[model samples]
Target: MKKIAITIIKFIGFFLGWAILSSILPLSSSENQAIWRLWAEIMPLLAIIAFTFIFWLIEKKNIKLHLFDNPVKGIALGAITGIVWLAFPVLIMYIAKIIDFDGTNSIDLFPVWVLAAFLNVIMQELLVRGYLYQMLKQKHNIVVAAAVTTALFTALHGGAFEAGVIPVLNVLTMSLLMTVVLEYSGSIIAPVIMHFLWNGIGALVLDGVSLADDYPNMLIATFTGNEILSGGICKMEGSMIVLFINVILTALFMFLKNKQGTK
Candidate 1:
């Protein structure tokens, strides 16, 4: 209980610090539309560095920098999981006629967009899966740790609430999936790769114009959007079908992991 409280406090401090730092950064129109644009681009990297340093200080030698014992296998499984996660939702939406590809748009600053996405996922997976979940697991069982981490993960996304109940629930389900990935893989690498792919592909499929409004991508596909099925503010990922698919996939992954362990 004390550890949980400390973790929560640390998270709150981290978020508050990030918000403050982002707010104070100066904007340059030559670079982007607004200060927030630059903030959105760079904040994840800063957060990653900050959190890593803090964790190193707190955990000392116990902090494991290596995300997995088997880097190759972990990375491969993560890639496969990411691809399946993205592909399944798109397939379901296409078949259901919830979305239609209108056309493609040009990507702007492709390299930077990819870097930002990578950093964002690395920071999230490290903090949530590598740090918080691991810390909780020290005192509590895996179920408790995963649940706490998932709840915190869901809460971190401010848009989840505005997107509606389904979106929030979808986020929770995805968080659980990520937790399972981390648990079974015994590494943060799998979840990191999976998360990056999820966000990168999602950005491409949903908005179709850019990785983000601020950062445009060379390859984009415009789609007919339905608020209910397409996720009005939440985008394609917030859809019910996508959530259902994620639940099934997560369960399958867990079952396979358990079977492998027994064998």
Candidate 2:
């Protein structure tokens, strides 16, 4: 109970620190378009740096920001997992006649977006899986720790609730999968790779399709406006098929990892 309380307090404090820094940081400039764009790409990284320091101050021993046991293997597995998850729904939508490919063009902002996604994955994995999970697992069982961490992870995406319940539920499910990956691999690298791939693909494909009017140099695919089957604002990740795939894949990963461990 005491450990859990301390973990919660530190978690709240870390976010509070992030909020304060976000408000006070001079990274953004209203008068300078270039500076604002740069800040937009790097804001998540900066926030993670601040949050890490705050967490270190609160819980010095539990923070494990190391990448993983076998980074190469982790990255490879993560990439495969990410590709499977991402491609499955896109293929389904395409085959259902719900997606119409409209051709491709280069996004000038693609490089910066990639960097941002990489940093965002690093930041999230370190915070949620690295720090929070470690803190909880110190006293609670893995199941309890994973549950608490996943709950917090899902809560962090509360803003996406506007997209609908399906999207929010999907986020929760993904969080749980990420936690499992981190646990089995004994590192954040796998989950980070998986996360970046998932988001990167979505930003490239889903956002490209959805925001074609807003972004000219995008590989657009017009999809049917069905939030249930085709997914609305959240795209493929929000689809029922994607959710089912996620559940099955997560269970499979856990089972395989457990079997490997017993050997």
Candidate 3:
């Protein structure tokens, strides 16, 4: 009972900390990129970094985020993994004639968006897989940690359910995929790069990654087919095909972890 109580308390408390810190910078949805950055990317990331320091400085818990472990190798692995993550289903959909490139809407501020996206990914990985996960693992176990983080991750993206079950399932499976990838690589860097690539490239080249906001997509992709293939208004990440790919990757990584005797 006490264990369960502690788990719940810490879980809720950690999220509350994030929420409080994140709101330190007032949220905004401005036409200006600088103002948007304060809301879209910077605040959340600052919250995560601040939370990490709180653990280290005050709580004295040095979370093993596996960041900067092997810079070149991590990025290399991440690039390959990220490419594969987007390529498999995207290629299939394109080959199926559901997706076609039209043109580009180049934006001068594109680099800013990339920075925002990268920082957003970094903050999310750190918040879910960094401190909270390590805390749970130390106090409980890996399964517990994974479960809590996965649920938190899904909840954070609750907008997926607005699209329907497939998107929701995709988010769920994606959470699982990141969890497994973290175990396999023994580094958060792997999933971070993979996630950024999945979103960044998708936003740039494809229709986008089921994101709520619209940006200057480099390629004007036209999709015509069943929602199962093209993902309809939800874009590629919401595709049934993407959900399937995520499931397969999740299982494959699980197998890899088990084969290597990782818990």
Alpha-carbon lDDT, every model: 0.70, 0.70, 0.80
User: Highest TM-score among the candidates is held by which one?
Assistant: 3
Tens-digit per-residue lDDT, 153-235, candidate 2: 88877765778888787888899899878777777788888888777666654552222223232466666767687776556
Candidate 1, residues 81-181, lDDT tens digits: the string is 89988888777777877666666676555555667667767767766776567766765577877888788788877567886988888889989998887
TM-score of model 3 (CA atoms) = 0.91
Better structure of 1 and 3 per lDDT: 3
TM-scores of the models, in the order given: 0.81, 0.85, 0.91
How well does model 1 score by local distance difference test? Answer: 0.70
- Score candidate 2 by TM-score against the native: 0.85
222: Cα error in model 2, Å: 1.6
Model 1, position 170, has a per-residue lDDT of 84
How accurate locally is residue 54 in candidate 3, as Cα lDDT from 0 to 100? 76
lDDT for predicted candidate 3 compared with the true structure: 0.80
* Steric clashes per prediction: 6, 0, 0
Q: Give the TM-score of candidate 1.
A: 0.81
- The true-versus-predicted C-alpha distance at residue 235 of model 2, in Å, is 2.0
lDDT of 3 at 240: 87
Per-residue lDDT tens digits for candidate 3, residues 1-263, read 99889768766777799888887767776878644763678888888888677765644555455666766766887899889989998899889998888777766677777777788889889988887887787778899889989988998998887888888898888988988888778778888999889878887557557443645577788778898778887778668899888988899889988998954
